[model samples]
Target: MNGTICQSINQSINQSINQSINQSINQSINQSINQSINQSLSLLQVMEQV
Candidate 1:
């Protein structure tokens, strides 16, 4: 029926939106973690040089 088709389409759209949101959140989290880790590592190296 038309209602079932619409429901399925809506479900798929919601699923895709959730997936993309999760992916972006994960990417940003990882990027920030990497940035902080690199900063700390460089700081350690500088401390050792000093």
Candidate 2:
């Protein structure tokens, strides 16, 4: 009975860790995309000026 409870707790902790990691990765990907978009826009503006 105790072992089962421990196992359940471990599973819950693992799931939380996995979710946090996934969220972090998604945020980084979003930031990268935003940076790329901003850079592209700046380049376009420069081209228009020329």
Which predicted model would earn the best TM-score? 1
- Judged by whole-model lDDT over C-alpha atoms, candidate 2 comes out at 1.00
What are the clash counts of all predictions, listed in order?
0, 0
lDDT of 2 by residue, 1-50 (tens): 99999999999999999999999999999999999999999999999999
Which regions of candidate 1 are displaced past 4 Å? none
TM-score, every prediction: 0.85, 0.79
lDDT of 1: 1.00
- Please give the RMSD to the true structure for each candidate, in Å: 1.0, 1.2
| Cα lDDT, all candidates | 1.00, 1.00
Task: Output the worst ten-in-a-row residue range by lDDT, candidate 2.
Answer: 21-30
